[model samples]
Target: MRDRPEAAPGAAPAGVAGKKSGNWKDLRARVLSAAVLVPCVALCVWAGGLLYGALIVLAMAGMAMEWARLFGFGLETRRGQLCLAWAACVGGTALAGHWGGALLVMVAAVVLGPALWAGQVAIGCAGLSLLWLRYMSEPGAGVVLFLVACVALSDTGAYMTGRVFGGPKLAPRISPAKTWSGSIGGMCCAVLGGMLIAVMLPGALPGAVWRGALFGGLVAIAAQIGDLGESALKRACNVKDSGTILPGHGGLLDRFDGLLVAAPMAALLSLGAAGGIAFWYVGLH
Candidate 1:
């Protein structure tokens, strides 16, 4: 028999070292991706015309591809083609101000592929809501920015808090990394962001801290729910992520899951309010 090898003089076990290092293994890639994409997204949102529309189209296409993959469909497959077609119609109709046609298309797709088309419809409606908020709402860019900022803050806060204060899982079966601490931390961060936006953009938002906080809380809840929903879907599909288009982020759908549901909710609230996008703080006119 061969002699056993001696341990290193002062070395920790490989598993221990690995656990420590792996805690933030993906941070660098996540930061780098955000650094590159955030500025581009902000610029496009600020310049809400062809540039923004193009960004939306590109995102929808990426999301559609990911959705198809989640369902075990290749781009050349009939289901994949239908998914892409739905994506195209949604983007085209949203940009062309024909949202009614988009709704009809969504219904048709749902009927054609009931199992796969539900999420596609949600994503399509989100795109439509974003377009409506940008081109049709009173606050336009400011409202979109506010929505983006709150969701971003929530996501960031949840990630940071979950890593630092590991505890009971929020939904271990769906996403083991998520925790109750992270969820609360995210909601708090979102509230702060909302209040800050209200202060900075008094013309676009109401001046009441309570209203800002309320709006932030609601958006955070919606965003978190969206995140959980996507996680469940990924779990059901037996996948770790929706796709791999964005390094560390997995895919466009993974990154924008929160925004997907939140946008439509925000738009619906705005539509029913007297002040449109600024209705969070503004009273009935």
Candidate 2:
């Protein structure tokens, strides 16, 4: 048998080098896409009204299309048309401030596609909740921006720490790349980021250090759950990403999975609070 070629002294193995190179390239692409997407999203959130509603509609449409693709349905298929119609109905109802109607449409859509119905419902509800949250008279865009920043920080922290301090996998079956160290790092970053954004924003967010930390931690955990759930779905589908619509981000679903879960969670929490989401954020209730 022929002998395998050996690496030179002080040089890394071919596989390790290749993996690192790929990671760096992927990271660059992610940064570039984020730089463009983040500002647009922020602008919409700040603008509210028609601008924000349009953004949500576009996002819902994109996610619905990608979700259909996940089940092997092409854009020309009947299933794809149903998916688009469902998304339009949901978006239109939610845009008109009829959340109940949007929810009913979501439930009806689930019966049409049972394979990944749960995720579909969750994403739709999240889109509606975001619409509601932004229209809130209190806190308003400040809270939305803060939430986005914290999630982004959590994701960044996890990716960075996981690479720097490789450790035991968090869930080998669902997502082998995630580690406990990375999760912990993400949590810490989320807390810090949340507090920082709250302070920077012109509002009474948190009103206390502990409150901010708690809120941030909850958001981070929810975000992680969302990320893991999406991973599991992709694993079941035997695919790596939902789509290739966004470079480095895979697809709209892939990019906003965490936000999808986190938004509803935040909205529910706010509604349950006595004063509202803004009050809860500020520890007033």
Candidate 3:
């Protein structure tokens, strides 16, 4: 043991050097991916028609492919499975006007995949909900955007809080880095974001304070669940990410995994008594 050669006297330890190099690579990839994706998403959302729909359909297809890949489905199996999943997602949006029917379709989508019924269902429903919100009119559009913002803020809060506090792990087996501190911080941020949205959207958002508070907190919880669920799946599969399409982000699935469940659940709760699928927004009032 004493005869074993040591690293150079001034050199960084191998583990430390590898970690630093990996972190820098991650940071660079994240920045690059965000730079391209953020603007494109913003523009498509702003356009709010065929442009957005097309992009969403493409994304759905990409995510479906990724999910299939995770399960080690062969090429033929994935081709058929992804095609069906993609169609189900887009087609179900047409039924969002009838919430029951749309939900039924999403339920059915749970059966149409290579493996992991849970993920298939969530992804399918996400596509349907995105289209529904887009076509639900101005208020729906705003709510969708607001939801995205809240999720983003929640993620930011979690990241900052977890890093600073570094307390008990949230799910050490699946996601070693997350902490209870981070989860609470994310919920707090979501609550604040919800209140702000209510003030700005008024009639379009839940009118009551309690409603807004509940909505935001619930959405944050859902987002966290979605994130953890993906992490668990990745761990089980022994993969770093669902795909490699998004550079630093890993895959489209990785980027939107949180939204896959959160968005639809939020929309479900926001349904108005008047049978409006979309919550009321500023212009509508």
Candidate 4:
């Protein structure tokens, strides 16, 4: 090292070593996070019957708890009632085996009635519950998977697009990270994901690709709204992350916020549209 140039007076060897150690630590953390996330994701994807349903139920329960925490509702008080109401709704849908007019009526009555009578918390819980029920009662595995895929794709696209092509912020107050370019990119990705899912299905693509694209675009918008809604709650509570249940991911609620909104809308659309895009496409068709 040609007598090894004298180390800078302020920059000790320890500092350089510390920096390398910090990098290794960060790398280890990321690797560990992926190690856990990958297996869990694989399990959910491969096991899509009762196991998947159970997972969904657990996820909804966890999300409900997180929501209650975010809103400052005591778990012993309002949360119990909320869970009960949600259970009832899910039970009703499962029993009926059809999410048509009856399902909508039940959800509207429960959510609006409670909002009008009990309070905002009641309404919020009911709304979330309805979304959960819709997610649970979706007809086929494929449609449910498709909806999830769209959300994932949208999120991924939005993040990448926003990072690479910075633009006007979508909502500076609610979520500074969100951008108009990201929103458009997310919508595009969602549409592409939906079309790809449709093509993969067994039968002829029921709804036109354009229709699926429109639905996906709408879902992307709704997903962002949902994300912002959750962010608002987090800001209100003065919490950085929801529960820190996941290593790198915040919490179950953090992960599923978009899905919570998108799933129900997709379910509703599937039920209404004539195209074989319904959740029950597998069973009904």
Candidate 5:
């Protein structure tokens, strides 16, 4: 067994201090990235239609590339094949309304990706599913925007509350930084912000604000779960961050990990009456 060297009398622990210092840099980078990303996301949402679709597809493609790189497939021919399949899955679903193609890709990934590229497969499928959430749902774009906003608010709440309170860890093994205080704070923010947005809608649905609050709270829950899932993946893969693609966020996957799982689940909850798309806007007057 190797020995852990003792710290000097007045000096900080060997690696701990460095980690603490790096955190500030990471947080600052996150803020800088958010400053640019938030406006762009809002604009695309407002624009709607092809603009939003194209942007999301591009992101998915980028994520696919990054996933392959993460799996050490960057230099292999499989990387191109996987990336192409991923783009087809996302773009097909977005442009041509094709779920079968995406499904096929998932099946192929499972069969061929058991040993390697499983994460890539999951990323591609999840990315496409989210795109489908935006593309296929009736009044989908609005719901997508709401989900994104709630998740964003939840993240902000978690960060602020966790830092301020510094209480018990929520899932110490999965994510050391998470805490119970952060969870509660995130949920509260989600509910309150969702209600506010619900009230501001053009035609407010009956109990729309309350229901929206619930939706937001649920979103926070899902986002946290996704965050944990990603953390676990990182732990298993023995890496930090997916990539350096995003200035502060690390990679597209790192930034949007929460949305990967949350979007699809939310879509299911908001399913429409006609067996297609979510009627999430139904109650909105």
Candidate 6:
């Protein structure tokens, strides 16, 4: 019989050994990541009404804290301010009960609050306010759900496409992982997801199917841009991960960066197309 090729140093002993080792590592990491993600997803998915709102509020608060931390702000002082400001903005939306103007005001507060404060406190507050407005003005829970689905699906598609196709990099400096093939795949997935949601929730959202598709495509592009923006920030700070909050996800900011930008834009488009009557009554009133 022919002699088998000699194994290299540090290599697995046999064919099965190498495969088994790789599988085990992957399984372990996935299991650990799932342990944290499953419960959080369930909580957001199953929870509804006030409970759901509360959970979302809490998440926004957590995200605000993370954002401040990323920007070099202290937790103890900035955290509380951020949480309070977010609560106030969300509360304002709740009080408005769907008022477009009120929702706009809240969004404006989020963007301007940071600049106004000109310090850690202001930045934290502004972050929270912006998040609150995002939830308030979107096409209700349905639109919010759709935006989340599209953003996530796009990201997933992009990763898979990039890995499998291995084309030219989209932006080598900002994000090495991004590829042109991946970007196209991601946008296609996003548009499909948007169309699916629009079909499912007819009365919940206004505008034609084509509009929805167009919006989805735009949001997909915007989300990708937002992701790159966050990556740039992390790189500038010379940090590996935003935080150790999530096992595989990294941090709240890491996961929500796309959502942060997409949510507000989706909301604005919905209001503009739908005429804000519903939002005015539900969000502002």
Alpha-carbon local distance difference test for all models: 0.77, 0.74, 0.65, 0.55, 0.66, 0.55
Q: Please report the TM-score between candidate 3 and the true structure.
A: 0.76
Worst 10 residues of 2 by lDDT: 1-10
The sequence of per-residue lDDT tens digits that candidate 4 reaches over residues 32-108 is 87578657754764465555555554565566566555555545775545643554454345434554643453455
Q: Runs in model 1 with CA error above 4 Å?
A: 1-18, 202-206, 282-285
Write the number of the candidate with greater TM-score, choosing between 1 and 5. Answer: 1
CA displacement after TM-score superposition, residue 139 of candidate 1 (Å): 1.3
Off by over 4 Å in 5: 1-23, 75-77, 115-121, 272-285
Question: In candidate 2, how many Å is residue 92 off?
Answer: 1.4
lDDT of 5 by residue, 1-285 (tens): 000111122343347676445434556667888899999998887676788777777877776766666566673676556664665564656466666766665556554466344654556556665666666654566667788888888877877676566578786666666778888888898889888876666555577777778778888888888877876766556666777877866778777877777776776665642444343443333
Candidate 2 residue-wise lDDT, 1-285, digit = tens: 000111122344357666565544567777789899999999999988899888988888788888888788768998877776788788889788787888888888766658646645876888887887888635778778867776777887887787667588787677766788888888899999877665666755446466667778888888888888877777777777788877777888877888878888888777765565552354355
Q: Pick the candidate with the highest lDDT.
A: 1
Ranking by TM-score: 1, 2, 5, 3, 6, 4
Any runs in candidate 4 off by more than 4 Å, and if so which? 1-46, 73-139, 206-208, 275-285
Residue 240 of model 3: what lDDT? 66
Q: Output the better candidate (3/4) by TM-score.
A: 3
lDDT of each residue in 1-285, candidate 3, tens digit only: 000111222344457456334433455566687788878887887787777777776777677777777777634784547554655554445543565665565566545543655555667678777777767644656667767767766776776576556578787666765789889888888888877775676354446455556667877888888888877777777776777788866777777877887877766655542445334222233
Clashing pairs in 2: none
Judge candidate 2 at residue 162 and give its lDDT.
Answer: 72
Error of 3 at 152 (Å): 1.7
Superior candidate under lDDT, 1 versus 4: 1
